[model samples]
Target: MKVLLILADGMRPDSLTNIPQAQKLIKESAYTLSGETVSPSVTLPCHISLFHSVTPQRHGTTTNTYAPQVRPINGLCEVLKQADKKCAIFYNWEEIRDVSRPNSLAHSCFYAGRRIGYKEAGEALTADAIGYLKKYDTDFTFIYFGYPDWAGHKYGWMTEEYLQAIQSSWDNIEKLMAELGDEYTYIITADHGGHDRTHGSDMPEDMVIPVIIKGKGFDAGKILENVNIMDIAPTVTKILGVTPDEEWEGRALI
Candidate 1:
């Protein structure tokens, strides 16, 4: 099965509930608004846990700056590559470039959110991702929208700006679903949430994220339990008909 994994960085669960498109997705998917994120709930660390199916302690990256894993574990992309699945990535943040190791991706597109405003960058990245998906026989694609995180840092979580950013992200999601149709399974989640103007905390606001899965075998409108950020990789591998890496600690949602 083809998979489209969308990550809206620092998108709080509450903000997702406020969006109409997100609510509709929840109604049509197996979702959990209370999915637990790993502690030190920052962007890169949480994303590393998501891709590697391990915690920061295991991955050895507790901060935004990525360091080579002390004992490398196969990330989701690496496993998919081994299985001969074509993968692509579209992201606005440069720091996320390390999510996949060398030559793991069939295509990648990056637009710096800081150079052009985060909102504009997200729009551009989404458009590019749509174009690429239409033209390629890709098995997996990751689309990272950085606007919500940028807005959260600039205007504080739950603020008007942050809510608008969430809305904008939903608009993009709607576009993707409409264009791609139901041929692909869509997994939408956040790397982490935020509190005040910053994150990296144990507070519920920072650790609670939303995981929404729309695809075959998922019960519509079902709210899941015991889901974690680390579960994402195993779930993706399962969808692609590949074995999860032995080092991965999370179970597949399916």
Candidate 2:
């Protein structure tokens, strides 16, 4: 089965309020609102863990800057590429480009969110992802929406503007779901949550995230427990019938 992973950066589980698409997703997917992200809870580090299935210490990316792994462990896309899967990425954050090694992706698209604004960037990205996924047969795809994090940082986390950002993100998600249907195993989550205008702390406000898994094998409305952002890659590889990287520390969720 094809896998589609969508991440809304800096979205707290409490921040899912009043979003129509998010409620629909939660109602239709097996989800956990208490999923934990790695310490530091920064964007690039948490995402590295999500893709590599390891913590910040193991990946050595404890901040927004990318750090080459001490002993390189194959990331999700690399492992999928070795399995002959066609992988693609659509994102607005440029730093996240290092999530996978070179030559692992079949296609990659980036929108300059910092320059053109993340909301506009996300619109262009979501449209491109939907169009590309429909026209071609892609085995694995990852789409990142950086607007929420931007809003959280610009305004304050959980503020009206931040909530609006979350709502706007789900609006894009709704559009994708409507256009693509449910052919893919969908994994929706966040990189990390924020408190006030910043994150990177070890507090629950920064560490707790939400994970939603919607697919054939998952039971809708089932409340999951003990979920982690790191588990996403393993679950995706398992769903796609590909092998998880040998060095991955996260377990595949049932």
Candidate 3:
């Protein structure tokens, strides 16, 4: 089964209430509002844990900067590439480029949100992703929206600006789904949540995220428990019939 993984960086679980598309997915999919992210609760580290199925301590990257793994373990993209599954990525954060190894992606598009406006970058990335998905038979596609994180950092979490950003993200999600149709198993999640004006804490406001698994084989409206960021890779590999790396510490939700 093809997988479309969408991540809204620094999106809090409670903020999903303001996003109609997220609420619809939650009502129609197996989901958890209390999914746990790794310690440090930072963007790059959380993303590494999500893709590598390990903690930041294991991955040795606790900040936004990318670092080569001391003892490298295969990431989701690497494993998929080895299995000849076409993979693509569309994101605004350049730091996230480290999630996959070089040459592993069949298609990649990036727009630096820090330079251009985050909202514009997100919309353009979504449009590009939709076009690429339609043009290529990609097995896995990762689309990341960075506006929420930018809004949170600029205007604080749950503030009017942050909620507006969440709304905009949902608008993009609705557009993407409408264009892509039902050919993919869509997984929507966040790398981490934010509190006040900053994160990187162990508090629930920072560590708690939402996980929505919507597609075939998953029970609609099922409420899940004990979901972790690390579980995402295993779950995606499972859907694609690929074996998880031996070092991966998470299990498939299905």
Q: State the local distance difference test value for candidate 2.
A: 0.93
Assess every candidate by TM-score: 0.99, 0.99, 0.99
Q: What is the lDDT of candidate 3?
A: 0.93
lDDT of each: 0.92, 0.93, 0.93
lDDT of 3 by residue, 1-254 (tens): 79999999999999988677888889889999999999999999999999999999999998999888999999999999999999999999899899999999999999999999899999999999988888989999999999999999999999999999999988998899899988889999999999999999999999999999988988999998899999999999999999989999999999
Give candidate 3 misplaced runs (Cα > 4 Å): none
Give the per-residue lDDT digits (tens) of candidate 1, residues 1-254: 79999999998888875688998899999999999999889888998999999999999998899988989999999999999999999999999998889999999999999999888988998899888899999999999999999999999999999999999988998999899988899999999899889999899999999999999988999888999999999999888899999999999999
Order candidates by lDDT, high to low: 3, 2, 1
Tell how far residue 206 is off in model 3, in angstroms.
0.2
State the lDDT of candidate 2 residue by residue for 1-254, as single tens digits. Answer: 78889999999999987787888889999999999999989999999999999999998999888988888899999999999999999999999899999999999999999999999999999999999999999999999999999999999999999999899899998888788887988889999999999999999999999999899899999998899888999999999898898899998987
lDDT agreement of model 1 with the native: 0.92
Per-model tally of clashing residue pairs:
0, 0, 0
Task: Give the runs in model 1 whose Cα sits over 4 Å from its true position.
Answer: none
Q: Give, for candidate 3, the lowest lDDT window spanning 10 residues.
A: 16-25
